[model samples]
Target: MSSVTTPRYADVAVGDALPSLDLPPVTRAMLAVYCGASGDHNPVHVDLDFARASGLDDVIAHGMLVMAWTGRVLTGWVPQSAIVSFDTRFLAVTRIGDAITARGEVIEKFVDGERRCVRVAVSAVDQHGETKTSGSAIVALA
Candidate 1:
């Protein structure tokens, strides 16, 4: 019998780390643009009165926007055919003027039967060291 070899997500060794991302800065104007682009007009993201009424002191960045930057880092490491899954958690609100960076570390790499795969621990943080989001990805290499 012959085996067809495919690229795997976790092919990287345990110590391998993906190239990180220094995302563009977040600004209030950017938030307005995002709100327009995404169509998530809950007011909490752009309206201060609504945000304060909802218990926050000020408008905050959309969690999904903050989380999605991890994609930039992950896609840089894995081929389009290799990714299997992706997700994240919101840890803290990112504010206008917050400088965010994305990073990932390979936690495990193993063969899923004949398919190679990788698992990464990922996070986004501000310059102040406040973690804005964290997540993981399980990729199946092509």
Candidate 2:
């Protein structure tokens, strides 16, 4: 965990090693629920045989799911209404049963006209320390 002072939102250069999220381990059932709720039923994320046949060694977790988990971390530091933008890049695959974590840090901050904005670096890593998703976020603070 890191500091959550949020001085960046005040147009000050402040950043810290943001707390990491101990997300529940990935599983087929979890993938299915996300698929059902999000309408992202790519077989490669749910069917092991289909995934292997398609060149993947096994079924993988949805990139967006991991991103969502990463974003959730910021909600505690900054109010949920303060999140203005979130961007992410999928670096590697996350497998079912793997424990994953997300970490973030404030990178830069400036006023976007009248808005107090902060740039945050966010990443999700699997048990192997393999980065599954990485990106930045711009948040508007009250």
In terms of lDDT, the best-performing candidate is: 2
For model 1 the local lDDT of residue 112 reads 85
lDDT digits (tens) for residues 30-133 of candidate 2 = 99999999999889988889998999888998989999899877876776667888899999888888888998888987789989888889999888888889
Where does the lowest 10-residue lDDT sum fall in candidate 2? 3-12
What is the TM-score (0 to 1) of candidate 1?
Answer: 0.85
Q: Whose TM-score is greatest here?
A: 2
Q: Model 1: per-residue lDDT, tens digit, 20-87?
A: 89987888788888899888887988999999999998899988777668976777776645667888
TM-score per candidate, in order?
A: 0.85, 0.86
Report every candidate's CA lDDT.
0.81, 0.83
What's each prediction's clash count? 10, 0
- Candidate 2: misplaced stretches above 4 Å? 1-8, 11-13
